[model samples]
Target: MSTPTVVLVHGAFADASSFRALIPELLADGIPVVAPAVPNRSLNGDAAYIASVVRQIEGDVVLVGHSYGGAVITVAGVEDNVRALVYLAGYALQEGESLGELQGGFPDSALATALVQTTYPLPDGSTGTDVSVDPTKVHDVFAQDVDPEITKVLAVSQRPLAAAAFGEPASAAAWKTKPSWGVVSSSDNTINPDVERHGYQRAGAKIVEIDSSHLVMLSHPKESADVVREAIRATDR
Candidate 1:
């Protein structure tokens, strides 16, 4: 079989740039990688956008998501040419599950205290709430392992997710049908590590654990890339 293209979807409070470190590693190994910018809006919209990107690819696709991006791919991975799913410290929610619902059962995330919410006017003339992690708390809550300078920049440039996004339940769970792999950030504070393990376990994904923060791809890019490489290799068989 031909090799699959790796489509990366980043989670909340982050943009495609989060995959910068991991991209080159994948490229060095001759793997094609594309990190789509998730809208951080509603799950359905984000999933649809990701699915659209997957459709644009000419060959098979291995869809990978981190954090909330996991939820996006879970709904998007059902695309015909998507051959696999990879979650990096991401949510692999089941049908009818929402990120908020899943996190409710787990220990409270440090992110809860670190978040700041603001109201913004939507194009539809409705008001929407946007959530951003406090820049002062970014290092402790999201990127403890990343360089202090980079974390500062990440804080300022971080994307804010729509407050409604967390409440939106996943309409479909592609993980149930697709082969999946997961990377658990052992020291993740933003999302409980146990919750991550449970999601991966339920999805029956091949799993790897890395000692890093929620931004595992940034802090431990090589290890993160290794898991993505493994997923691509598995699908090639």
Candidate 2:
């Protein structure tokens, strides 16, 4: 069979470039990759958007979601061409569950206190709240393993997730049907690592625990790439 496309879906507070380090490794290994910018609007909308992207691809695809992206692929991976899923410190949410509902079951992490919420205007003249890590605490709350200088840039360029997204229920969970793998960022500050472990366990995904921050693909790209490869080998049938 032909090689499957590896579609990297990034979570809130990040964009496609979040996979910069891991992208190179996948490319060097002759793996085709596509890291798309996810609109952190709502769970249903983001999943529909990702599913559309997958539908446009020509061959089998492997979805790799980071953080919120994990939740995206959980809904999108049901696409017929999607062969597998790899969650890199991502949320493998269950059907009808909201991010807030899942996270609420676990104790709040540093992110709860570090969050900086602000309002943004909508086309209808209404406003909605966006949540991001306080820029001053971005390093400790997001990815402390990354360089301070990088975190400085991360602070300014980071994308904020729509607060409504958290409470919005997930319409579908592809992990329920697809072959899946999960990585736990054991040292994550933004999300309680237990949350990651619990979600993966529920999904029955092969789990890997890595000592790193929320940005596992950035700090542990080699190990990250290894798991992606393993997922491909096991499911690229």
Candidate 3:
């Protein structure tokens, strides 16, 4: 049998490039990986766009989502090829759920306040949201475990998601049917560990916890990858 294909969907404020480093390692292990860059962070558009990519890859598939992308995959995982779903410190929005409402249960964190963006006039003089982070503080908040060079690159490469995606709701949650896997970052300050546990429990997914930050894949790639492989193996049994 051919190796199973993996589709990686990145979260808000990030594009497909977020998986650039992780993909190479997985590919080296003979896993076929595809990371589709979603346009402007619209989950609705993202799900539709990623589903298109999912249709093109052959064999059974494992859909992986990080942060907000988890919610995207949950909505998109209903596609025929998706055999398993993996959530990496990611959101798992349930049926008819929206991030706005879901976030209510979780206490606000420093990451929330740090996201305040300034609107500026674009080339056409139309005002648009231009998001930025306190570069000095990004390492501690986003990619502390990643190589300093990589963390700097990611800080500069991060994109500003349109405000609309946060309010977008999931119509159908695929995790209800597909077997799931979840990774919880115990030290995550952006996404509360308590909230992550709630999501993992709700999905009834096989769970793994790590004493890492929000970016667990970058912080603990080998372990994160191994957990993902286990999810793929679970589908075999």
Per-model TM-score versus the true fold: 0.98, 0.98, 0.91
Q: Work out candidate 2's RMSD over C-alphas.
A: 0.8
Displacement of the residue 66 alpha carbon in candidate 3, Å: 0.4
For candidate 1, lDDT tens digit of each residue in 78-131?
999999999999999999999999998888878889999988899999899999
Whichever of 2 and 3 has more lDDT, that candidate is 2
lDDT of 3: 0.81
Estimate, for each residue in 1-237, the C-alpha lDDT of model 2 and write its tens digit.
Answer: 568999999999988988989999999989999988999998889999999999999999999999999999998999999999999998999999999999999999998998888999999999999988889998988999998988888889988899999998888889888989999999999889999999999999999999999999998999999999999889856
**Full-model lDDT for every candidate:** 0.92, 0.93, 0.81
- In the predicted model 1, the residue pairs found to clash are none
What is residue 110's positional error in candidate 1, in angstroms?
Answer: 1.0
Query: What local lDDT score does residue 19 receive in model 2, on the 0 to 100 scale?
Result: 90
Per-residue accuracy of model 3 over 1-237 as CA lDDT, tens digit each = 346898888886667777776787798889888888866546677788888889888778999999888888988899988999999998888888887777779897557766757675557987766454566556777777778887787777776766667787887799999999999998887787777788889999888999987888878888888887887777873
| Best-to-worst TM-score order | 2, 1, 3
Q: All predictions: root-mean-square deviation over Cα?
A: 1.0, 0.8, 2.5
Candidate 1, number of clashes: 0
| Model 3 vs truth, CA RMSD | 2.5
* Per-residue lDDT of 171 in model 2: 89
